[model samples]
Target: MGMLNTLLQAVSSAPIGGAIGAGIAAIGAGIGIGMIGKSACESIARQPEAASDIRGSMILTAAFIEGVCLFAVIAGLLAVLK
Candidate 1:
């Protein structure tokens, strides 16, 4: 019974941890997207003729990163609400 109570207390106090996780996920996503944009721009500058191709691939990669970050945030919300 004592262990059970302790577990419950821990769970109840986990919202802070969940919020931190979400924040970290957001930061990571921002960094990832920024890097992609930076590299794409550099590539385009080096080869203006291939700008179209570089832009297309950059957009796709950024979208994927955003999706993963979204999932992570949702998971964090679930943890906080649990």
Candidate 2:
């Protein structure tokens, strides 16, 4: 897509720090999400009756993590632009 191409071009021209920051943000988010999933699974396994509530909480927490990750990535990209 045109947007992808533009992003690629901008990245290619940018300094390394922003790219690294973005990568770290993505990696951290992945780890956080993974931990969340693992914990949720364990909790569900240990308490089947509370599965619905745990699942809901897990999803909400994951969404919040993702939102934060998105902001971090954007900040990194904005640094790249600068």
Candidate 3:
């Protein structure tokens, strides 16, 4: 029981979880952005006339994802620091 409690305490006190979460969030955002860009390019290729609109929408969506990722990173950092 004593050893178990010590192990639990050590695990709970470490900031590894927060760091891992932050890293995951960043990676997820990168993948999401990449997908958006890829799909936008494909759409543009299929409809060259709508390339401008597709590019604009893709940029907007990527910005939104980036904003959310930024917030996630900040929250994770706070958790680790606190």
State each model's CA lDDT, in order: 0.95, 0.93, 0.92
The sequence of per-residue lDDT tens digits that candidate 1 reaches over residues 5-71 is: 9999998879978888999999999999999999999999999999999999999999999999999
Error of 1 at 52 (Å): 0.5
- Model 1 clash pairs? none
Per-candidate TM-score against the hidden true structure: 0.88, 0.80, 0.85
The candidate, 2 or 3, that scores higher on TM-score is 3
Cα RMSD for candidate 2? 9.2
* Among all candidates shown, the one with the greatest TM-score: 1
Q: What is the C-alpha RMSD of each candidate to the true structure, in Å?
A: 1.4, 9.2, 2.4
TM-score order, best first, reads: 1, 3, 2
Candidate 2 lDDT at 48 equals: 100
- Model 3 segments more than 4 A misplaced: 1-14
Clash totals in order: 0, 0, 0
Tell me how far candidate 1 lies from the true structure as C-alpha RMSD in angstroms: 1.4
